[model samples]
Target: MSGFERSETDEFARGARALVIYPELPGRASVGPEARLAESEGLALAIGLNVIRKKHYRVRSPRAVTLLGGGQVEEIAEMGRDLEADLLIVDASLTAIQQRNLEERTGLKTIDRTGLILEIFGERAATAEGRLQVELAHLDYQAGRLVRSWTHLERQRGGFGFLGGPGETQIEADRRMIRDRMARLRRELEEVKRTRSLHRARRKRAPWPVIALVGYTNAGKSTLFNRLTRATVLAEDMLFATLDPTMRQITLPGVEKAILSDTVGFVSDLPMQLIAAFRATLEEVISADIIVHVRDISHPESDAQREDVLHILRDLGVLDDEQAGNQPRMVEIWNKLDLLDDDRRTELSGMAARDDNILMISAETGEGIDAFKAHLTALIAKGNDLRTVKLRTDNGAALAWLHGRGVVSRQYVDGDIVSVDVSLSRQLWGQFEKQFENQIERANA
Candidate 1:
């Protein structure tokens, strides 16, 4: 019952000392090892772990047993002992055998990047659906690592207290139990997905548009969300501070209202299990009419971070393979301007000036927020144009359709004719003409 086998309360306590290590592999040069180590440290701190020591090693060839060289493993064990650390946090995914070997050699509880992120999610998940999703993902992860990771699973148990036949290994019983629980979680999550689809459909029928805010973790997305919507979500400088999806109604210039969604941040090497488990929540991003990509302009790896976010968006089918503008309109927001110096800020402003779709703003200081709102309004109103149509008094269905799909500015009745002025998007306008061409007498666009 060691490590993850125990309840969370008895596992890693708050303020537990931790030794953070990053393995720098060959042919991986997107981000420097130092920056990646810093991010890993932030993740450790986010889970309330006291990072006593941090270091990185160049792994010319990763070892199958420990993922690190024998000498490197010895060095880490000695460092952990000297630092009196309670945990060893590896900034890479490890197999169950590799993890067990590392724990035996390092003499400290060991967890990898995926496990650490899962722990943070398990803690930060606020809503019931979030907890369920986390549990399902945790179960999925633990299902394959039950061999030597959990010592209690080595025992044999009888049928009554176990899951399988009369004489079954506890590991088998535990695996069976996990499978059953996972099946139930999938069913429950399916229901949640159905519920989300219903809500999305209802919003689709509404006249207002949907805008989603997406970015790297702790990239000032929640800050921008609060700044725009005036709702107090937990805006912290910690990784994964927000896990569940939050939505609010906001009014953009030239638009009465739009649904704004603040979703979980994206990261490099995001666990595939999490991506699959949280599909119900990420669907909000897929159905968004517009996507606002928020970036931490002050971070050194901002460009790399942008690529990571875009990669995830593409994975979610929000973007096409060609990326030839056949997807939702997207705008890149350069946030955290307050953290940049004058020279860097000026340089970025020059770059943004050349890009029509990029906006430089400080979400915390409200700098350029008015312009941001106006730009958002422009994107929303891009294809919509004003049209005046005269219809017969009996064409009630067409009038209702116009009201449901467009912004009806004016309507008047004269004799047997009704004149209506509406602003409709190009797609909606095309639908209107196709559906009600015979019902209208005259139309001017």
Candidate 2:
């Protein structure tokens, strides 16, 4: 099997003997030590893949042809052949040449971390936008192995041995085709962007607030989104169980309706290519007036995961650099409080009260939900108050102008005049001022 055939083989099976390779310092001395093998197996099981047989390898020689000695590769291949294993899943980046070479030697299909992720995305993508993003990422990864099928083309040719030409060749044409498809994908995503803007505009008109659900994968974002909003989105303990973004109208404790959006979960070492692919979806976090940094307080790396999320947010320019002296309106949802012991929960609660922009609550058991709602209500009130204006309505045009640019909270009408109160952004206020230039000019005159 080559190219497309192996690509097809990468999917799940009922009784697949899967060998997950997590390389360590090779030849240092070890005996079949599985590096995170159980974790990898659990991840596979989440996607319905049955892993029957498993093994691990510790290889040194970072640039070796086999990543190990010839004897070692032969021994491993012999084991696979003896056990009739179905797949080899390497939990690291692998070059096309290395992949093809390994598969040929092992007589089994080979895949890397990137390919496995793309496979999962392909299966989980629920919307047109999600599918397009996955396809774009897949194409970027696949472009490197255009001629993996034809080894003849990889042989020493006119220019460079095993690489052929100095600059480009037929494989370059395949890369160009991928680029052309990507450009078209970018254009299609622009339409998705426009649709997202329209949705944001509609949400901006909502009487409540917008709270975005964000955290590491399987940190229970969807469960919290469902509990808070009475939604039925898929909530499971799996890596990337949710692919598309889902939004629901929630009634918080203060009788306030808020739009709670469940976003794609973050992971450790979220591939750069996948990040670029899913940038459009992540703008939800950026547009979010308030961010709910839900955490799996039980996870060993929970602190590091929180740091990663904040780092990415700041890098994207969404996180403010200012001290934000005012009570941060940003609620830290200490989700999965149900998972913590009473003492741990008490300690965290005290910490949250002392900290700004932090809220401690379990989205699953509905614990501390009232406090979460109250905190959200206060933030919403503050966010809405960021801009407000009172206007005398002698000029119908000015009234009409403000109406287009913002939401009208109150209106009063009397003889030959009208009084109106509106809430708007400063930028929108600028637009209203531009639209009513004639009135401003006459007043100045």
Q: What is the lDDT of residue 72 in candidate 2?
A: 63
Candidate 1 has what TM-score?
0.87
Report the lDDT of model 1 for residue 113: 88
lDDT of 2: 0.67
Total clashing pairs in model 1: 0
Per-residue lDDT tens digits for candidate 2, residues 1-445, read 0112224244446456766666554443221245246556655665566666665665666544556557766876887788777777766677777777788898877776677777777778888788888877777777777754533223323322233356767677556656776788789988998888898888775434567888877888988888887879999878888889998877654333567889988764456677888888888877887888888886656776676776566665667556222316456667788888889888887887797677777777888788777777566555332333334456766766655444555666666556555555555556656766555422210
Residue range 170-219, candidate 1, lDDT tens digits: 67778887787788789999999999999988987665789999999999
What TM-score fits each model?
0.87, 0.73
CA-lDDT, candidates in order: 0.85, 0.67
> What's the CA error at residue 405 for candidate 2, in Å?
15
Off by over 4 Å in 2: 1-15, 24-39, 53-61, 64-79, 149-173, 205-208, 253-255, 320-329, 383-445
- Identify the runs in model 1 with alpha carbons over 4 angstroms from their true place: 1-10, 151-162, 324-328, 388-422, 426-443
